[model samples]
Target: MRNAMTGLALLLALLLASGGAAGAADFPLAGTWTLTAADRITPAGVREPDYGAAPKGRLIVDATGRYSLQIFKSERTGFASGDKKRGTPQEYADAALGSSTHYGTIAIDAAAHQLVFRIEGASFKNWEGTTQRRAYDLKGDRLSYRVPTAPDGNVPVSEWRRER
Candidate 1:
């Protein structure tokens, strides 16, 4: 009985040590999140939907700190030609402006309340191989962040809810 008790105590100690390490490695934002809203705040303080009335998006953050994000305007016009390469200038412009996508590794600076995205690729070529930072807020199962202000004096905001 005494030998068994000693072994159990040793096991408990090992578990405690490993648990601490795992907890340190665990990412708070690691989860699949769905976009709830994509909005822009104008200089006049009006909040308007940036991706139409109903935006569609998904964000997947894995345990390894890699992430994939995609957001699209639900009201985007379809290409009438049914061929991407044959699209008109207006169709191409609409397609480009109607969606945002990127995949890469993410790092969080909790002290600064910032998220740094090391984009591997993006729908916008200018974002490829770039590092972008955003101020973020994470509460309960909801996460929200604000993009850098655009030249047009609009501030974009993205809100997401974790998927069950």
Candidate 2:
């Protein structure tokens, strides 16, 4: 009877291990991704780049739901002084406006086609402690999402392609 019980316990352990692997496999978005586009659609139906002509960014989402995202314009002007702390007001403004970065815990509601971000920190102070929800599309290796409308009556969209 003791030998039978031990065999049962081992079988249960193997089942649990396989179940965990299956769960991870079911989560398709847990991977590194590269930005494809960052654009905005104006109220007048004009589509324009939101992060300059050659925007650069990365999105990393882990199996445990933690994520870090960053986007930056390619044409940001460099400070003449070459010192971050000694940047002029215009340089500071340029630097601030040129990048978007945040780290947060992410939750996806696949049935709703939406994802929520519980932002822990952000380059933009206003978003540091905010919760944002975005409607998303996941097609094969590509993921796209739309941000909330901006004050300028434009809707921002970001597209990413899975890297791994």
**Best prediction by TM-score:** 2
Determine which window of 10 residues in candidate 1 has minimal summed lDDT. Answer: 17-26
TM-score versus the correct structure, for each prediction? 0.84, 0.85
Model 1, 20-73: lDDT tens per residue?
456544788889999999999999999999999999999999766899999999
**How well is each residue in 37-68 modelled by candidate 2, as lDDT tens digits?**
99999999898999999999999988777899
True lDDT of residue 143, candidate 1: 95
Query: What does candidate 2 score in Cα RMSD to the true structure?
Result: 3.5
As a TM-score, model 1 comes out at 0.84
Position 18, candidate 1: lDDT: 62
Q: Where in model 2 is the C-alpha error above 4 Å?
A: 1-22
lDDT of 2 at 91: 89
What's the C-alpha lDDT at position 151 in model 1? 85
Model 2, residue 129: displacement in angstroms? Answer: 2.0
> Could you tell me how far off, in angstroms, the CA of residue 107 lies in candidate 2 after the best superposition?
1.7
**CA error at residue 96 for candidate 2, angstroms:** 0.7
Count clashing pairs, candidate 1. Answer: 0
